[model samples]
Target: MNKDFHYFGTYSAAILAGHSHEDALRIARSAFFVDLCTQPVLNSVGAPIEAATTMLAMEMADARSDIISQQDVTRTWASFHFLPYDLYSERKGCGKKYMQKYRLICKPNGDLLVDTVTQVKGKSLEATGLAMHVLADTWAHQNFAGTPSRVINDTNYHFFEILPDGSERRISLRPNPASPDDLIKGLFTGTMRQGKETSVMNLGHGRAGHLPDYSCMRYRYLPAWADYEEVIKDNPSDFMHAYCQMIYAMKYLKGEGGTFEKATYDTETVAPYKEKIEAIFEKRQTDDSEDWKAFGESLSGQEIPDFDTPDYLEEYHKAPEDKKDDTPMGRFILAALAQKSMVTNRVYKSGNILLGISGDYKDWGTKGIRAYLKLAKEVRKGGVI
Candidate 1:
């Protein structure tokens, strides 16, 4: 999901789940920062490069598709963005090699989702926010893997958008990442296809374009891994579920529920506002930040401030080194480190070397690997990611 869902929509869910306005902003901001907290962004903010939870487009585009780079990409993208639901998920008659990529396909309610939420229980709001981002994505990014694999991630011309009237509109895609999807003309923009089996072009939903990012979109397309079968993505439904589930998960984080579980939603709490929420989803727009921000304000009787990526940069820079980790940005960095560690450890434990081996930093240690060692020091100190 984009900032609309990860930021404002998350704030809406947190408010509905009983978080105070101040607390909700922290959660929502951290959720959005999962995308913004990249190496370049963190460097500019004067943060340790080890704290970046994502990669900039230039970094990703220039990254090699070799095995080592693939592992690095998987560590960042899989941990933060397209979190794999189950590392051991199976496909009938599939061999071990193909299963590696298959296991990375994201779906909601998997064990990793449970680990993601429960790990942050009673932790910082930033951790809760980071978990919310991963949880919301399981709904939006379902059926896609985090790693680069052409056979598993490629798409053909069999794309169609399911309109509100239950009709289908054929989608014509062109390679133009500079512009947004032209829904009015049924034209979309996506990455140009690359024949290389592990090109970054084949990663995530790039092949499907931003259709998966917009909550108002629902489409039918043939997945490269689905053996020519058609899968219909009812995004309004999925996005709605994501919002409700975020509330449920947030409630658990707020000490309401006993434990966080998959497939549960706080539909009861959101029922009264369901109509308005549905309206936002049914509007068929590329972005819904304004609608979500308005609703969040209504929920708490306070303005939902614009998300400034560097909002906490000054705090980090001015604080004493010993107290730097006490700032919101510091907490966010720690949470990012923790979440990435937990997910990477899980991937390694599941016997999928596609993301490489996971080991204790105490036992081993990168900008190449030294930078990773430095990050591991944070995780070792905190006792998680």
Candidate 2:
């Protein structure tokens, strides 16, 4: 068999199986990253940049992948908790707690690689999804630091002040999985508010209020919904882009944004998913301008944009209140549509999407192979076009 003939199948089949192109790409990209870290491969600065593009491209694909149902999203989110520590680990300085949270390792080079820890303690799926989000953030930070960097401090996590009416409103960062963007509000330009009911900050904070020594670190808990809306007001385009990606990604696979028929576990699910699919079929005879136009445009493909900006990213700032409810589906649709151009442009710039899979990489070609396979699946499933 020819070495190049490693893959054999129709792209559509992959899609029907319910996997996204981006997920496939990420598996491949991850393989390449692993190889580079393991093998003594020489590389240029362009290599890492290209690798970064592949990472984001796969993410875009995942963000747009089809969701057959909200349950699917929930299950997938849960499954992430099982991801092995070795797959995405990094070392931290010194602490005995949260050891399973992640692992520490040394690369072939002197750079320390912190692996992403995805398992949720006590087998909680909701906790797992939250864990994945935190891990994504941690990976983003570690990747940027690139070498001999700590992923988290065993004793360190974020703290937020829930008292909005009192003087105790504040959010604290301890440097482990600590991102300035996470700590501060870019748009509000002041301290972040911790919502009374839903604290977005707490989603990342993990083990909070439970800490016996709560006063050890100060916390300002902002209203989750308010902060969410404020995020939109502060940067309508960016918030729209972010939420759009999440919604559309769920919708692409499930045929509706995966909000549930009713709220379960205190969260919204996709009644919209079922309704939108029905509406699409029901409205079929009545002139299909909006969706048809969008579908037609999607064939061209484009890339999703990054939402974090310098201001929102700065330490200890808040976003404005008006940003939450602006232009719902439109934002997501535009972001997903951008994939066509982004992928194509990057491919043209480099010879292939596997720009990061270079230097002493032979077997690791599977990384690229798997990525394309994932892409083919997504495209065929109608989650991506």
Candidate 3:
């Protein structure tokens, strides 16, 4: 989902779960940082640096160690992006099966979240936040498999023009699916990236981009190659369900529950937060704002620390390895790395369930965790990876 859910919505949910404002902010910030921590860099002077922005920059420097590459960075980022799709169902090449597993739609038999929360029980708050992200996604991202497939998301384009008075005029589009030209023409928003034919890397809802992640967006689109039309009218309900799950999860983390029973999204629980979330969405749309960093800062009520800053780096270096887990940055990194590991084991590794491919990637999770830890050590010792 977008920052609306990852940051603001999560913040609201934390409050609803009875967390203090400060703790709620911390939870929300760590959850949101999952999307922002993609850029792992080594500076010109060969010092590992924190991310300056959320934008992906995968290029590696020649002066840096040759062990890591752009592909490694890309895979790492993919681990984060595909976390919600981590389903070890042992079903290969079935998009619907994967979606059902990923989204926890067919419950009792299909829900993996009960097991997921149980495993991470009594873990750090950062881990809870990470789990919450994957949990929340099961609702907003229902029906879309984590892997890309044209069969899941192929679409024809039709444009709409917004007038000065805030009305829309539809513009019809008719391009051959086989040889479409200038696909960007008359498209007002979303990325222009196209996926390769028959590849798992092909994205669902590429036409709508991140629109599906927004709580207030209600859209219907007919996939050119699919049997059924895709719809997202009840996203508010989905968000509400997600909020309830977050509350359940927090309680689970506190040892108040053995299993997460989905909470009732009644008016008393959902109304106040819904109003604020809807207002944020409306303001963003009206302003045409893409400034999620600024928006996140405003919701957080403070400046997020720049990890590259000396004070932050010094604190990280001085912490004992065992005690590091108690620090905020340490917890964040540990949770982020742990989430990446789950994705590697549950999603990317072939033959578990969902999509299967042949390879020896079982150690990917271990390798990635080791890599991050190594980077942490290097940073502590005044070096870079």
Quote each prediction's TM-score.
Answer: 0.94, 0.19, 0.62
Candidate 2 positional error at 32, Å: 27
lDDT (Cα, 0-100) at 130 in candidate 2: 26
Question: lDDT: which candidate is best?
Answer: 1
lDDT of 2 by residue, 1-385 (tens): 0000000100111122233544322222222222121101212211111112112212322432232222122112111211111323433563432232232211111111111111112222222222222222222111111111123211122233433233443344332332322212311112133332122122112222211111112233332212222110111122112222223222222443343221112113223233332342233122223432332223224221222223211211232323211222111112111222232223223332211212211333335433233324323444333
lDDT, candidates in the order shown: 0.84, 0.23, 0.48
Model 3 lDDT tens row, 1-385: 7665776667656665666666776677667666655344223212223321122423322212222332243234333343343344434565754443333112211234554555467666766776677677666655554434455444445434333345555534332334332222422344343554333223444444554565544445554333454442345456666676777677667676456654433345556445554555544242212343344355445453422334433455567866655666566666555444444445434434332221233333234334455434433443221
User: Which wins on TM-score, candidate 2 or candidate 3?
Assistant: 3
- Candidate 3 least-lDDT 10 residues: 44-53
Question: Candidate 1 — what's its lDDT?
Answer: 0.84
In angstroms, what RMSD does candidate 3 have relative to the true structure? Answer: 8.6
TM-score between candidate 3 and the true structure = 0.62
What candidate 1 gets wrong by more than 4 Å, as runs, is: 361-385
lDDT of 1 at 200: 86
lDDT of 2 at 117: 18
